[model samples]
Target: MRGSEWVPGVQAAASYEARWLPKDVMAGLVLTTLLVPQGMAYAELAGLPAITGLYTSILCLVAYAIFGPSKVLVLGPDSALGPMIAAVVVPIVLADGDPGKAVALASVLALLVGLFMTVAAVAKLGFVADLLSHPTQLGYINGLAVTIFIGQLPKLFGFSVEGEGLFADVKGFVTGLGDTVPAALAIGGGGLAVILVLQRFLPKVPGILVAVVGAIGAVTLLSLDDVDVVGPLPQGFPPFTIPIVTLGELGMLAAAAVGITLVSVTDTISTASTFAARAGQEVRGNQEMAGIGAANLAAGLFQGFPVSTSGSRTAVAAASGAKTQVTGLVGAVAITLMLVLVPGLLKDMPQPMLAAVVIAASIGLLDIPGMVRLWKQRRIEFALATAAFFGVAVLGVLPGIAVAVALSVLNVFRRAWWPYRTVLAKPAGVDGYHDVAQYPDGAHIGGLVIFRFDAPLIFANARTFREEIRRLAQAGPKWIVIAAEPITDVDTTAADMLEELDEELNAKGISLVFAELKHPVKEKIDRYELTRTIDPAHFYPSLDDAVAAYGQRERDSA
Candidate 1:
């Protein structure tokens, strides 16, 4: 690949014009407003210090700006990935009783995820993301939203809850409700309300920044010692760090790494495709994998955890009229400046307010409207979505995602295993064969039946195909003409089934013929020598020709 092709930042820079500079600068500023609060909130959500969130944000932005394919995609610590990070790292943290060790483990996980993504990009395995179908993706995200919301409720109420899973978390919150600090609750609730109002009525405003600043002001003026705050942040750029872990922990980390890679790549591609569509740009999935891989690699090396493309932040940038990756670079620079000049800007920001920030973001992840649409449009898909929701809600994040992937793959096989098959006949005033059940008035030739099987003849459905053929033959038709246009391929098992069916039909004094057989399918039959067992002349290029030949044979016999 050429330099321009591999490095999207170089391409963006070459095409840079003065006209876009002002817009990009403004977009960057607007993005920083959300990035700062979100970075910290998600970092804490991930079982890491709030400062690491800022580190992840800065490094990922700069790295993606240099490598990402999309002009507007904003990479950062994501609400969705936070709980997953926590799920994987929190247990290790408890085991070691050291927060630093947990952070190191997460960094190593990020590195592994980055390597997985990079390897996939190099191998052109972008289609691996397709393992999660649309329905499964919706279910997983909705479940994640519920999990995050429940998981953060304890923090939002100004208390910590100990739990093993989503249900336990909810139970812990309910039981500990009496222990919640009134001051903390008031500050957190008020902050959340302000943020929600700003988002609903004044979307263009920087709601998170306003809410955080207001909470800080309230804490200062009232001397609210009861409310938990983030306290002072370490001042300076993120230090270069190497993630260290024991060899025994490598297998566990590898499993977590796979989950992170799946979620990160899927989210990145979906987000990139969405923004690209709006901008009239084509999405390169493989390139995006490489780009996000580079960003994660940077984060892992810079005291950060795994990061993903953030839909909310990306929308902020796009809505603010960002023109290029320069927007991300500007945001990175702005964040670095804040760390240098005002590292303690959010020192008095309440923990509940941060929880509110994260909870609000997670709320956006729920697709209730999407679920409704699915219900109205496709009930089976809605069911699949519901199953995925329960999978995550009950089984926990990692296992739930695994179940979703399994369901997605099974859905594909389920369709192939029992695909639609129908008897076809020439309908009145119709030019071609139609399903006899759907078109009851259609006429079948005196001694011929036209059957249509609407899927490929693969191993899974081969027996079904053979059985259906036998059943249609029992209808007493002297000849069976298969409308094979829908049959794309005939696997070895299906070929053997076909050969056996041919012999059985011949023994019953019925001849089997195939019409509109695709060339590739015909070649498979020929290769299997099934064409010799039945007559090679039984194949026809069109249904009409097959019927015509059958009619001529009947007339010659009469």
Candidate 2:
């Protein structure tokens, strides 16, 4: 725990001052009011009891208030990370119908994740989260969204159906169509409709909350206890207890830990960064990690599942003029009070309405505007986006996330396989050699063909570079100059291949020249005696210098 924290060791976050006006007390209430039901809905999405979400929301805020770097960001139970937790927990619970055992396993998993994140924070390894690129993340989220919607359909329709995968769930749902409770269905459908319509028209109207309340009121007035309520959630102050897990359960929970750690850290850090960016405040990635790390650990202790940065709720806090982490503290206190005293109020809340809230939230994450922007800027990126979108929508979440990740890896390989290599030429008034395509009919310095490879020289595309050089050399070019500015590092295989090419060029009396080599790359060449193999004089700082030197050498040879 950071010593500067107001709450001592319990606190997981650090603090920063807002240069402008700080967040007001009313703004905190506005965000809290929005978050109370959302936390429950997201908890249901995570395959945990509704109250676990409430516990997470409260504890995370308290933890973040103590340790959070950003004042405007709110930490809570997030729908985005829900599918991942469900994917991990459902299989385990299906095998053993013990809800207590499932909770135990999850608590242990959450604790481990907290420790992992805290360690990562101390090490300043926050950037490791970026290993999964944006494209892959998009695909993962898309897939999860579809998976969640499919899984929640039964709850939405007020039917009890069981299936492991999306297709199986859909099939089971169809088979059990007759069991749908009409009242629950009405609440679900109406809640979804109202939520969506309000989001579109009334931005600050608290649509989800209103829909939930309306659904509850409708269910109560119409006497629909025949349709299920979430039941009196295990409410009151969180009891302090250490998570205990057997070795077998721990082993089973490892994969969940991996998935949760990634999702939790990604959401938390991104939300913090987004809030900080909007407020023109500096963000500390390590501090954010520590905040989230403590939140997860606190949640685990409080019998809550894993928690993360809630994007929608964070935006709410930011928009509500939350100037400091105290807003989160206030929100936590508010939720705690709701859980302790008003537990009976939520006893008859409809499951379908919760499902509807989740559905409404998840659908909005599709990012239509972002896709449009990407489509106009880069068609290839747009294609990747479409692939992820459909892949999640149709194929399901697990497979969709898998496809997105695979696509990202493949994208990297594709660029490496056919890296941008351009032939350079000197234009009429340009300072040095530039890409011929970029210049208007630029001259090639009288038989000197200069080529620039824009990526690192490695085994993946070294052959292509070699082949192009040989072809250009054979095109009656007396000298071949490589503009090595963008080419950073070279592998041993590339160096060996270059050596072989150098011998071939020497025999044909065609000079191989290199210009503008980065110091690191130049050092590699020097270490390998590449400069000895090819004359040291051939190397120059500028393309013009190389061309002039080559021309002078030609004149001397003549």
Candidate 3:
């Protein structure tokens, strides 16, 4: 068993309750229907043969059910990641156009992603997800949806052209508009319409599946063999094979691998957390990381690209009342049956219809309510959200992710490197110390300035800390008291600088006192023996004790 197997909030999944079997089976059927169309469409998105998406969907769910910590999360190929993978693979595939080479490269990318996730899990670095702030992710995903929706349009029109970026893709579409394959456009566009209509009224009726049957049947009746259909996909299980890559190729794939991995982790964590919350459960971050790692590992070994949790499939399971991870297993099994029994069912699936499948699914990923909540509740978050959204439009999805990461990192230092430093004094009704800004006009003892620092003392901000203290105490208080409760840590460089400050203050006949410091901090000061040079008598257990001691010392001197 893995170290995180006994994760809290996941015990419910392990409980073998026979009574929940009916609910689980019912949920399974619902998710199975939804997963079918999505798996195929996402395969196209990943720039692999449509069948590889089916393989990824089958194995990912099977592995996740056995290893995942969340009960409601359904593992499958995702719409959100489809275009991102396409953006990477399409260019490569178009360059070579070798089906074997394409499959090999995809498998390699999955392997690299799996290894990366496994390393992150072991290192407990799943928190690296924080690099993308919620605001930035919001913007990036929304922008990705736009790019994907547009990219699919050309395919729906049965016109194939190539481009590297969003604008270039639009240009290709315009240039190819004159040569639009009428048969391809008819099948893809008509299929898309059928799906949209069915989704509105017959959501549980496997609309995409229905559309596939109708489109293929119509094309067959019309004898339109000239139209570019998906063609006969292999009707068998995926054969185990390794992706071949040279060192030179690895460096190029790294960017794609890193981008896909980031998006995968982001999707997995968010979806798992959502489902866990629904189950009144807490997800094990490392366990979830390992589960996703295992899925990608399987994808790499077989012929597939990188994958993540499909929000739409998982939501279908939850909404259909899936009681446990059983639904994910069922979905995987259904995908296997499709491969073994009916691979040709999707050979004629219209490309535009496939695009519609993705577009419809992406509609749910909009996150309008969440963004609205932020708008009403916090302006800063709203600004971040908008910035990220626009950034994705201008900067592209991967770069937009980078933007989010940068903002999140800056936020951490923005407060720590320049924290609040307030002066305090005791009067009446109030306690030992209060912010001078909050309590002006209050009587002061006149000989002391007690300033509180709200963050740890470190080299990055020590100079700033000293400057604030100096400026605030220029009123010439005989004693400078540091209400050091908030500050619980310091680096060696900071400790040495404090000693210098102690010496400088002593020469000016001003006493520097420290109070309410955590025990660990006190130990460090003792380690440096800073107490030998400064007045040990100035240290106090509490702010009250320090203030009272100062009053007593003044009375004794008078």
Local distance difference test values of all predictions, in order: 0.90, 0.77, 0.77
Model 2, 81-183: lDDT tens per residue?
Answer: 7776777677778778777665666667678778888888888888857755676666567656666777788889998787666688889889988998888
Tell me the spans in candidate 3 whose CA falls farther than 4 Å from its real position.
1-18, 97-99, 170-228, 368-395, 425-432, 436-444
lDDT per residue for candidate 1 within 404-440, as digits (tens), equals 8998999999999999999887788888889978899
Clashing residue pairs in candidate 1 are none
**Candidate 3 lDDT tens digits, 1-558:** 554473422555557588878888888987776777778788887777778888887777776776677777887788877766666566676777665677777788888888888888888888877677776678677777777777777887877777666787788989889988788788777777777787787876667777777777877789877576777888888888877877777777777778788888887888878777877888788778887888888888888778788666777788888878887777777778778898787776666667767766666567777778888997777877777777666677667666767766776777789888887866578655788788886666778878899999998889988787677556777889899999989788788888888787777777889999899998888898888787778889898888889989899999
| Model 2 regions more than 4 Å off | 1-24, 372-376, 386-403, 428-431
Best by lDDT: 1
Runs in model 1 lying further than 4 Å from the true structure: none
- For TM-score, candidate 2 versus 3, the one ahead is 2
> Worst ten-residue run, lDDT, model 1?
1-10
